[model samples]
Target: MAELIVQARWLVTGVQDRHTPIGIDDGAVLSRDGTIVATGLLDEMKRLAPTATVKTYPDHVMLPGFVNSHHHVGMTPLQLGSPDYALELWFAGRMPARRIDLYLDTLYSAFEMIASGVTTVQHIHGWMPGGYDAIHGAATKVLDAYRSIGMRASYCYAVREQNRLVYEDDETFCAKLPSPLGEELSAYLKAQAMPFSDFLKLFDQLTAENQGQRLTRIQLAPANLHWCSDESLVALHEKATAANVPMHMHLLETAYQKEYARRRTGKTAVRHLHDLGVLSPRMTLGHSVWMTQEDVDIAAQTGTCICHNCSSNFRLRSGIAPLNAFEKKGMTVGMGLDEAGINDDRDMLQELRLVLRAHRVPGMDDDDVPSCPQVLKMATESGAKTTAFGETIGKLEAGRGFDAVLLNWKTATYPFQDPDIPMLDAVMQRAKTNAVDAVFIDGEVVYADGRFTNIDRDAVLNEIADVLAKPRTPDEISRRNLGRAVFPHVKAFYDGYIGDGPVQPFYRQSSSV
Candidate 1:
């Protein structure tokens, strides 16, 4: 491939340097063979790569592509009418979604993410009831979609030995329900069950099958604390350690989860994981909204990463995460749009702004707030750490892949173009999906001028619509009805268990007034 030089009016390098600003005025990046060769002023880059083909964007700002650290099922749940219920109840409504073509489903969200400037995603695959063959096919289709879209993805099938749906065991939960519903749920759980050993074997199979894929890598997830038994957790840790791959799990995402940890292990989820010997730098805990200061300390000491899903927390009424505290503890916190953002879309730019404002704790002290640079890093470099890519794809430097997004300055930096205003702040606050002009991954332009180069966006959406237009099967209809019926019991169980009034918000205290 020929050398490529991309010049923009402004560039945000997303480099990890506290003393220096991330933006560079009149910046350019030079790349060849899918790797960036240099980043510097336009004239300097031109001098370095004198004969390279140049692409100039006089009215755009380039930044490292965003990474979504935790995601699952793409747009399946939302497209099928699952509202933003609490995590536990949401699963019930989501269970009935008609199985559409996995490739189209994955690409639907990939389009939204790429249009919103995201280049990497951590896809936590779960809830495939057809067992190993079904899951393997779905995983392969999802990976194919990502490859066709030219986006990097870290894929992991979530492993759960118990508590498939509700917090209680299947027998206990079924026993509490009426006769046929109980029988139906029990049978469903039985059908869905896969042994812990089988899941590990499947993981090894996938790793070997996709060993040299350019844009996709395999990882592991134990699902969550309550979902996995102690033996399963230890086994997962050992397997991941032996394989030298990252492990991500859902931990303390909701108040009930915190209580479950207390009831099940007599300790916090973080402490239990530490005891299980899984809280390492390779482990990333998703939606850590309800963790205490001590849990944060343990996470920091163990070099674990946290993926903060700001919109999912707010939409599901999962309290705000103590992101400020996490930062204070020097923990690596990455931003993620778990299911979708506040706008019910995977818009990373808006997600960034939401994260920047979410942690402002009504204090006049500027130190109490998250800066633009801090949030930018969370979306880029820090987020990359949560995926299998690690430090390879987050920054713009020599030897790093050219993964980036170009924002149209006309919309991103409009009305307030004062030179004194920080460019990064302006982009974060004002940029929207419409402002995204182009996106690149591994030195290739995947999306440009509202069109995807690798895949036919319109054709894929049309196919998905045609598939979804079909009537739901009898089994699917029954699942939907039963899920709705079971939701009340699930809610009541949690309500009775967490009877201590209301859980306080992370930043609020009872004596503050």
Candidate 2:
């Protein structure tokens, strides 16, 4: 019967039918066993739970912690030697990434996320060289890292069956290559293949292994349309439905990916997935950057969710997602810092501001652009809907988990702030890591002031530095050589691959959908 109470100067409970949060000045929250029981004035909370432990923040503004709905790895791809190539070429560029231990790698990003008020992550991990056991071990390490640091993680081992290198099939593409590169690439893809049933088995095993975990949940990922066969995609959708989990599949991330979908199925990615019977509330499309008007209609009608990785699109040269269009259609949208953010790190505070400002489409159309509260909803409640944890962990309300962030009001509004500006708007636009006074998840404070409560962040970073400071392993050297050798062919595969014509732009303001 552990009870905790946070008496804060202000409490942002949640957003309702308004453009601002449902806030209370001089408010408090009472929780028992990690679930919020009541929210009201400080005196009311104290009367309700007199025996609860109280933590007071006199000059802080409390809000729900954010959810990063789509993520891949801990370290950024750029940090691992991959240039800011376009999405298609970036895959080849990432082939030679130096290895880092999965546990440490997960922590590296978790630290950044927590510091910026991100409490949960949809950690989509994949592209391993070993079979089921190896992949499962890797998944365990990632999960362990999240648990060790007290952050919540909805983890899914991304399932990639084909298209190991380019948009072409593995066997077809390998046959076109010359000399040892052919055998080398084939062997590499072969090492990653397993019976499709094994993927389901792995999901079941992970679910069982995480039955009683509060900080962990297991979900499914189909990797992407080009990487998954139709049969496997259907099977994964069925499995996820039966297991009561969500699927975050990367689709139409780039113009080339949109082209691939059309070439393969003679239809848009959304249409193909809809025909396959996979589009539903349970399916979350990672990046709908190049979706057509019809695609938006399909996604809206079928209740398919969207994850707008704003910075990832810019960094990879993927077109900006028409987020305003999605909102206009009443589609649920979430924010994700895929691969890396605009600044090449997982700072959700920075990511939030980027999303807020990026979608202003150069017009004074009141309803066409996103508002401050709308972006906040995307980061919190809508983002939670994309993961296995659902909407249960996104808001501050009765029956919801007690996860929140407290920002120093002075720091958030330092120097001078206009009284006409809303508190959330002022904070979103100006606050940085220094304003992040505390982060709470599951009724417990995991990060406070300048450090993680559960782990020594500096020690872990030094450990990573020491490991990388050593000479590259023989395996790493070989992969680097292979990447260099195959770079030319990989680039050549997309030579005039995209048909030049008037493709649909990011979005149209007024659609009848």
Highest lDDT: which candidate?
A: 2
Best by TM-score: 2
Cα shift from native, residue 26, model 1 (Å): 1.4
Model 2 pairs in collision: none
lDDT of every model, 2 decimals: 0.87, 0.90
lDDT for 404 (candidate 2): 97
Off by over 4 Å in 2: 507-513
Which digits, one per residue and each the tens of the lDDT, describe model 2 over residues 180-298? 99889788779888778888899999999998999999999999999999999999998998999999999999889989999999999889999999999999999999899999999
Query: Lowest-scoring 10 consecutive residues by lDDT in candidate 1?
Result: 14-23
Instruction: At residue 256, give the lDDT of candidate 2.
Output: 90
How close is every model to the real structure, measured as TM-score? 0.96, 0.98
**Residue 269 lDDT in candidate 2:** 89
RMSD over all Cα atoms, model 2: 2.4
